[model samples]
Target: MDRAFRWAFIGTGTLAKKVAREITASERHVIATAYSRNREKLCAYCEPYNAYPAISIEDAIDRSDVDAVYINVTNESHYEVCRQALELGKHVLLEKPFTMNASDTEKLQNLAKSRGLYLAEAMWTWFADVPLQVRAFVQSGKLGRIREVYMSYCAYSIGYAPRVSDPLLGGGALLDIGIYPITYAYRLFGFPLSITCNGDIKNGIDYGEHIVLGYDGFDVKMDVSIVDTKGEAMIIEGENGFLANPGYHYGESAVAKTKSGVDIFKGQRSYLKEFDSVADEIRQGKTESSFIPPQATLDCMRILDECRRQMNLVYPFE
Candidate 1:
């Protein structure tokens, strides 16, 4: 087997720990170094994986052994951290909500392109087999002419996760959780012709939103909330029948119901696939991910930007 892929982790938060567990367990990946604002936390996070604790972001990425950086920093810090990694010539795998907005996302993409370094959004849904099968089923004419799509990613993160309600950290329901359903629609149907959004905003943070992505012949309706728990099922309606993807963002399976019969597509729900795929792409000297292409990320960010515009929701820094 080839040498394990080396990674420098830039954040040791809850999400970072989860990823660390998955990535380190695989033979194809290992954490070379880690950095966090809290030194104690960083040390503790690195101890479990036997990874080095770096003093700073630059220290972590500037190492000769570190081939890529997995950035799970706060939503507000994505662009700068990713930019810094790319500038240092390390490939980057950034967590979701890409960069707070499309402009920053595009900048990072262009920077990666110019530097000849690998860059990807780390939107795991796009790499999952179920969603890919669902997209293929939709395009195979088995679903017939698409009529409408409905998706919801509502969860009560505001009360439990303080960062979800903090505007200074680029917090809000739209950026925190809405991207799942929006990206789902975009992956299946491409860019929309128009977008209409309505939401509740308080204390400079959004609580929830209802978005309609208008396509050529149909509209995808999506609802996202951070203060309440609604269902998170993605339903695709077509002339033949309908398909339902539960927990669409991170789900492992999707079921399609049609007049002929029912079809089920299932896949693994592991971060290992995500890390391994990215490592393979980088090893092959690719500058962009085929799974979550740069255009798709930019288009989704543009959609999020539009939603924020309609609702007049802006982060404190922006």
Candidate 2:
């Protein structure tokens, strides 16, 4: 029998609402409690899902019923929430942009490993089903040594929220929305031999970034920006065929073409995949999630750190 795991949410925001919506759809996962600095907001948010609305982070993690915690708070709060949860012997699934830097990410990963606990970054693409097909398409020899790949995810949000534009909260295009393009390039080709980055900055935050990742065999052109909302998709070109993916961030079903014809792979999965993955890992007493492995998260953080270094993008808190 599988353990129908009880989950605690550390922050009540739009993401928490999303988690609540998805948790009800998973048989093995149920949100047991929720906590936000604003207690009334927390109670109102969790009531629909029958979750105990706690008053603080400590209260949520201290619940005996909570098997794991889903940390979907702001980027700045990721490390602290994850650290506290791990210390309380709770498994953690963190939202993307794992931490302010790779150092914190590595430290948390080490802590989880040492404690024989499970910790996973909630990078939904890793748990999605289409990325497997996307990887297969890249490795199938059908593309025949992808010579050139151009990918961009432009999120031009006018009048963005404070968290999106605040440096103290780890706000920037690279960490907020640019991570998708970087992850795409990293997924197909390993870390680049050389990376070149340029960004538009205002109010100590990067509104947009154009990145060029040079591999030994090929080069990837990636542009991600919140300043310019044009061209919000990805294109991978090879000797034989190319893949056209719109909104590549979520692993949406995409189309690949070859000489014979275009082969489209379509299978839409849910955000619950991450929740299900962690629950099963905890049920089996596993220390790591195979879906969103720790090393991959570290790799992502390392790439972002380097990108920031090149762009001279630094957070006040860091």
lDDT of each: 0.90, 0.83
- lDDT by residue (93-127, candidate 1, tens digit) is 99999999999999999999998888999899888
Return the lDDT, model 1, position 9: 91
Q: Which stretches of candidate 2 lie over 4 Å from their true place?
A: 1-3, 158-160
State how far residue 26 of model 1 sits from its true place (Å).
1.7
Clashing residue pairs found in predicted model 1: none
Which candidate number has the best lDDT?
Answer: 1
For all predicted structures, in order, the TM-scores are 0.98, 0.95
Give the C-alpha lDDT of model 1: 0.90
- How many clashes does each candidate structure show, in the order listed? 0, 0
